[model samples]
Target: MNSEIIITKDFIEIGKLIKKIGLITTGGAIKVFLKNNIVKINNVTPQGRSTKVYPDDIIWINDDVYVVKREK
Candidate 1:
């Protein structure tokens, strides 16, 4: 099953997302995680950590996938 997160914003950064998903604990950990893994948004790998994730976007990290859903 895919992991899911609810948001009320237009977008969220990949680093922030890493923490939200509980995949990485500290802010510094994101750097190492990103260096070793790729963040795929909508099935496409993003260029860098600043990649914006919107509602209904599919994000892939490590061996899992997360679905971002907007909350009204």
Candidate 2:
């Protein structure tokens, strides 16, 4: 399966993306992911409050693939 984010605006924040995409229950979850230190942004565990997520980026937590895109 592939998820697409049609550039509706300039850029989307990772925390916002998680909520917008329904990956987490609340914005607090974004903190949990950060506190636990298990979320990777663009293939590396990110530790920033304002991490910008652009197009064609991967957001993975643990072994589950939260965000991904595949070419058909």
Candidate 3:
């Protein structure tokens, strides 16, 4: 099953989402993680850490899948 990440705002940065999900602890780590791992947003590789992710977007990091959902 895919994991869900709840967002309160209209969008969240790819780097922030990585950090929020506990994949990395520091902002700089996002760079390293992105470099070593492939992350796909909506089945497309993100431009970078600043890539905007909105609600209902599907994020894939390696074999793990994450679905973005708006907070109710």
Candidate 4:
């Protein structure tokens, strides 16, 4: 299943976005994504909390790829 929502400047942090959208647990967000070794940013592993993720950015976690996009 797929869903979409507007990010209205409030969905800044990944952890917050994960919980705010009822996507997953904050702990799972940290363990699976925040680890960098598991998640990929722009096709490469990102190692930072301040990784400004704007619209159209593709985040890959395991076999699932979450495509970021501005609500238009």
Candidate 5:
């Protein structure tokens, strides 16, 4: 599945984005999920949950794709 997230801020953390989009239920699960799953931002694997995702960034989690866009 593909999704798009509109953000008003300059950037959003990878962990928060994952949860915000309903990928995971709890905040604590982010670490485990990132460890077990393949997640990339703009075609590069993020360093960790603290990775900043800015607008126009593309996130890939397994086969799903998520695009980040700025709020207009």
Candidate 6:
């Protein structure tokens, strides 16, 4: 499913975004999930959890595509 996330700030980390978006229950789960899954940001797979997700960026996790929107 396709989803849109409205961010009130500049950017959010990939891991943090995952948790914030309710994709995962906790930050601890991100490590395990990332190890077995892929998080494609702007059509590119991130190499680490530190990848910065900014507004207007498209992120793909599993079968879901989440579009990030900025408020400012």
Which candidate ranks first by lDDT, i.e. highest? 3
The ten-residue window of minimal lDDT in model 3 covers 26-35
TM-score of 6: 0.88
Task: Estimate TM-scores for all models.
Answer: 0.84, 0.63, 0.96, 0.58, 0.94, 0.88
Best of the two (4, 6) by lDDT: 6
Cα lDDT of model 3 by residue, 35-56, tens digit: 8998999999988899999999
The better-scoring model by TM-score among 3 and 5 is: 3
Best by TM-score: 3
Best-to-worst TM-score order: 3, 5, 6, 1, 2, 4
What is candidate 1's lDDT per residue for 15-64, written digit by digit as tens? Answer: 88888888888877877788788667888877776778898888887678
Instruction: Return the TM-score for candidate 5, rounded to 2 decimals.
Output: 0.94
Q: Which is the better candidate, 3 or 4, if ranked by lDDT?
A: 3
Span of 10 residues, lowest total lDDT, candidate 1: 43-52
Off by over 4 Å in 2: 1-7, 66-72
lDDT (C-alpha) at residue 35 in model 4: 57
- After superposing candidate 6 on the true structure, give the runs of residues whose Cα lies further than 4 Å from its correct spot: none
Q: Model 2, 1-72: lDDT tens per residue?
A: 335644455567777876776667787778776777567777886656468776667777565555433333
After superposition on all C-alphas, the RMSD of every candidate to the true structure, in Å, is: 1.4, 4.1, 0.8, 3.7, 0.8, 1.2
Model 5 residue 34 CA deviation in Å: 0.3
Q: Which of 1 and 6 is the better model by lDDT?
A: 6
TM-score of 1: 0.84
